[model samples]
Target chain A: MTMSHAIEVHGVSKRYGDGPLVLDGIDFYARSGEFVSFVGPSGCGKSTLFNIVTGLLAPSSGRVLVNGVETTGSPSRSIGYVLQKDLLMPWRTIMRNVILGLEVHRVGRAEARRRASALFDAYHLTGHEDAYPGQLSGGMRQRAALMRTMVTDPDIILMDEAYKALDYPLKIQLESELMDTVKAAGKTVVFVTHDIEEAVTLSDRVYVLKAHPGQLVQEIEIDLGTDSHAINERRLASAFNDYYETIWRSIGAGGRTEVAA
Target chain B: MTAFQIEDAQTGAVRTRPARSRNRHPASRRRTLLVFLQVAIVVAFLAVWQWGATGGWISTFLFSSPEQIISVLAQNITTGELWTDMGVTAQEVLIGFAVGAVGGSALGLLLWYSRFVADLSAPFITAIGSIPVLAVAPMMIIWFGTGLVSKVVIVGFSCVIVSLTNAYRGAQRVDPDLLDLMRSFGSSKTQAFTKAIVPGAMSWVVAGLKLNVGFAIIGAVVGEFISSSAGVGHMIVTGSSSFAMNQVLAGVVVVMAMVLAFGLLIDLLERALFRWER
Candidate 1:
């Protein structure tokens, strides 16, 4: 029961106005309903890749396909992007903020409102519809942001370090919940993160990119088993050593010297 | 055994209850006290001024008593002359404000949309804004005559620059992330302007309008002082020339009332327009 590819990037390269290339001939793909993570050091062009994929920036070379449709410099309607910041409109209520994407896409007002309401319970945001973004806790704000992105019903979601702002405990909690939500929704996701454990814990496959003209160094398939709640310390420790060590070595981190082998 | 059971149930209920609300009663009381203190200060100052004038500590001719000003206001009100002059001034101010607000907003949008226009006209606009409206009033009178048109033009001239500068700054200060989000959505230039740029610029626009209300009043009054025959400013001129201190004070009071009323109206409009900001 293999899934079809939801997004495909082939030999994509991006450079800034005759400057050094940021992304160099990167090849990546996410299967339908798959969760994939891109992990690397700072300045590794992970965010650049997310931008190019979402059509915010054009790649210097190569093509991207979304749901088998060729998407070269095309407006990214088929994909939803969640930035690091919640980016909720401070002036809008929680409900209004969640419906912003649908509003932008010109979805009918009534239908957009209907879709936004359906996520309230699922996202644990019930009873706070009229509250402004300022009134929300950080976690609740992020949840509203996720609802905003998901309300568009995009087949693929592009997240650029979306949970990096949360504290460690909250980040872990959110990562697990988000993974469950993405899995249940059956949407493909391409997440960029600096944290290797986060990449491994949430992703079905992780692409390790190298810095300075970022290139895909390795792609590792994660097998975390079917039980979503099986996030035991032992499993995390082992995955950290196996995946983080390899990724670290690729980025010249003295090959796992920081953590026990 | 029954006593222990009851205590255990009570403790369980207390543990299950939600956390106490964070609302502060003392803070609200302090805010009320502060407002009361402000009103008291204003009242005390007005009382002292009135007492000094009436008690002969200050010459009545130089500084009319509050009672005298009030009586003059009442007499003028009963005769309906105050309303006529106020209505005329109000008309000029309203017309000038409308023209200035619309023209300034449109020109600001134009400059925001085109960098060339912004750079080319920056110096000229600055020069015009820097020239005092009083200095330009005589020329305006020569061009438009001692009529409503001259007063309106003067008010518009005084107001347009403030609106333009504030609006331009507002439009230019759009959040980069919001713009990126719009761009990612493939929003057309017009769509982006309507949704992101316009709403973001509204606070500044309202602020400029607030300031321009006072400027508009000044422009109209000064224009009338220089030339007009039928406004509160003209009444002030007649009163001063005749050495009627009470009449001059009455005219001043009317002008102050007009300014205060316009300022309050703008504040109400701001509240309605930017309710989300609260």
Candidate 2:
């Protein structure tokens, strides 16, 4: 097994023109085939950090290395980013939307269609290839978004609350599917979500974060002894609540939960 | 009939679900009645007007009864005068609409590439757009002469501003998320413009086309009114100068028909283009 990191963020800090640092000295890394998540509240600069990792926004201080080379000021195709919203082009059919990256990369039309068709079948979106995004359910749209990202075959995947918009049942189902797909591909994933249970269930390691100039609080390695690919089963593991409570406390939402209880 | 079968969430038993009733074909027999009522209103209106004119209850010379206008239309059609005028006017309106709407949208969307150019031209575009087409019509005629060129220029002028502004606004309002997605893919600026920005602004561009349909017709007719020997506008002007109400109303009827035809054409286009939206 390769122990080298696939992505590394070295003391990254971001500030907007004399404002307080949006991200304060964030040191993060993801090893090959590892699933890492940043669990935090809103305004925690998770999105800012994701953008920096994607090279869309440059950090004020420090650098990002992708595949061991510095990638600064220029976005590379080595990373695939799936955002909170599906961002599917409404004018395009599901099939067309999935092939957008290939199209931008100047892939041949026939080849792009062929590659995209395989994803539709594997993702169980076979019959919906021709349907527009508007006609699909929220879960299906999110699935298509994931398919769009995965088809590009980026070594590192960055998801920013990608499944937060789905209902509980769909979220769990997609999480399982995502886990299986990433495992089979052996791709490193960096996920950001405010859902503690989600972070606990899906991630191999979780980074707890606090708001207001977003800083990392703790890093917890999850070892539930359950199949991570089976996210629902992982939720039922004995270590689930302990990990959730620990991350929840780090986020400082423990008081509210206690009051509610 | 059963459309499909599914397991009930609570019972875990398979249940056949009936197909949804679209109600596309209503059993209520009101379609014919509605058509008859609409026809009745129009016929009643014409009958009352004709009766009033014949009985001297209204001034036939001023109002030009429907029968008199029909007679004038028939005469003009037989002489081929009305056909020539309509053809000229339609040609101008259509050509102007094609050129102006397309050209303006292209220029507006192209502005997306350079924020500096867009910001620079904002006030100038507003100033030019605010200037009434009537004020510019004479200047256009003086420069280009009272030929088809001037009329075409006038129609195009009336259309260009609205289309430019609408298309530009639409491009501006495109969801930033999509642009971010494009950037994440490392798409070139031109690719982003063509694949994302242009398609994003299409609905607004189409709306501009619809609005410009009216402006095009108005411009053509008004150009004819200013200085033209042939066109619906000329027919209306000649009839008015001679106090021939029938000819004037005939010209009006022709223009109304033109507007309706263009409106229907645009509606058909909109339907075909936006099929994916729903």
Candidate 3:
């Protein structure tokens, strides 16, 4: 419980009843303020691992420690999760959707409104306060979801392919915004992605997972140290290809039986 | 859809061709024609009905003439009886609908929240729902007396199952992803219920409400038929007793208009509240 890591998983294993392990002996950690990524081919249990970390699903075996406290099988407000879909309540305005977490915690209505409202300008969502989620574009919807997740100021944020749905340009834009914001706020983030280039571009460290008894096979440190604030600029860096190549090769070398999503 | 338009076969291609007379502006002429047809049919039916009733082909006692019914309606309006009967029926319907909504939704939520209770009560609800509502009307009158109380009870009885079924389905059908997101925020069961489950099921609840509107009117009217001093149903019963065909038809027309009004009101309210949907 007193570990120095911001989050840790030890010997985590998962399986649906009587089924073969989807995740086996999965061990990883993110230090405080670290940006970590999990990369694998389709069906590599990357999402399963993220779901377990978010406490949305049980691990079947092993434990998850968030900020040195075991949070296995119990959801905690300290960690925020953003699923692939925006999951915005269609009935609520964008502002209200962003305030849902705070509202659930019984923060007074005005206070929650103020906190949520503050993000509108910062997140490029100004003047969209009264708009419903359905009215927004896909990229904007995801941004609102990010605003919702980050508004609560959770210590750890788990993203399960949060940007894959957007077009390339918006995906890069959002990816950049997300990293810069999380880095500036000093929050630990664990992102799961199918695209190795994205994994390398966004994270300080990328964990390569193998399918068919999904397990961590390699952990690569991305030391591009690029000065560009934009993800497109990061991708253009001379070192970007080397990092992408490395992660792709690592994933390609893993188990070929199971696919990733 | 714009990628492929229907072919103008004689012209061999649609995109290069100017619009045809029939297909011009897509729905332009079709729209006007449809509306015209609808109005023409209504007028034609009324003309035939009026002709038949006035011409003595159909007995006046059996099927009242349109003119006679209109005069009867005019008489009721001038005498204040139309408003009184309408007001009485509207009050019963509104009150019954309110009570039924509350009770039905509460029980439905209970069923959704508790597996044990839902399993136990499923068969009972089905059994009660199958019972013809009119059969219970007399018993309800005997128990609660010929007043608003009995009508409300019958309305609630008629409506609870419809609400319960829709609401319970709504709760059960919530997106698991939404539930997960709520839980990740440390929301308790009650919080999830209020914040996620209920909103997820609001559409279903609205559907049940629409169904309840018809049931509520039926229960109220039937209760009145069993015994009541003033209501649309009471007027119809009295008109029938005295063999006043015009009055009876007028009472039926009023009831029909009332039900249509209620339906339209609900539709408007739903549209306003869920404008975000469209």
Measured by TM-score, the strongest candidate is: 2
- TM-score ranking from best to worst? 2, 3, 1
> How much is the lDDT of residue B38 in candidate 1?
100
Model 3 lDDT per residue over B1-278, tens place? 24346667698676544345556566777789899999999889879989998788988888888889999999999999999988988998888888886578767875767888888888998898899989888999999998889888887888888888888888888898998888888888889898888878878888998988888888888888889999998989999999999889999999889989998988997898798898
Residue lDDT tens for model 2, B1-278: 24577778999988986545534445544686788899999999999999999999989889999999999999999999989999999999988887787788888888888889999999999999999999999999999999899999999999998999998998998898899899889899999999999999999989998999899999999999999989999999999999999899989999999999999999999999899976
Query: Distance from true position, residue B21, model 3, in Å?
Result: 17
- TM-score of chain A, every prediction, order shown: 0.91, 0.94, 0.96
Residue B193 CA error for candidate 1 (Å)? 1.9
**Is 1 or 2 the stronger prediction by DockQ?**
2
Predictions: Cα RMSD each: 7.1, 6.7, 4.5
**lDDT of model number 3:** 0.86
Candidate 1's DockQ is 0.39
Candidate achieving the largest DockQ:
3
Name the docking class for model 1. acceptable
On the 0 to 100 scale, the lDDT of residue B79 in model 2 is 97
Looking at model 1, residue A244 earns an lDDT score of: 57
Query: What docking class should model 2 receive?
Result: medium
| Angstrom error at residue A59, model 3 | 2.4
lDDT to native, each model:
0.83, 0.89, 0.86
Task: Check candidate 1 and list the clashing pairs.
Answer: none
**Selected candidate, larger lDDT, 2 vs 3:** 2
**Chain A TM-score (model 1):** 0.91
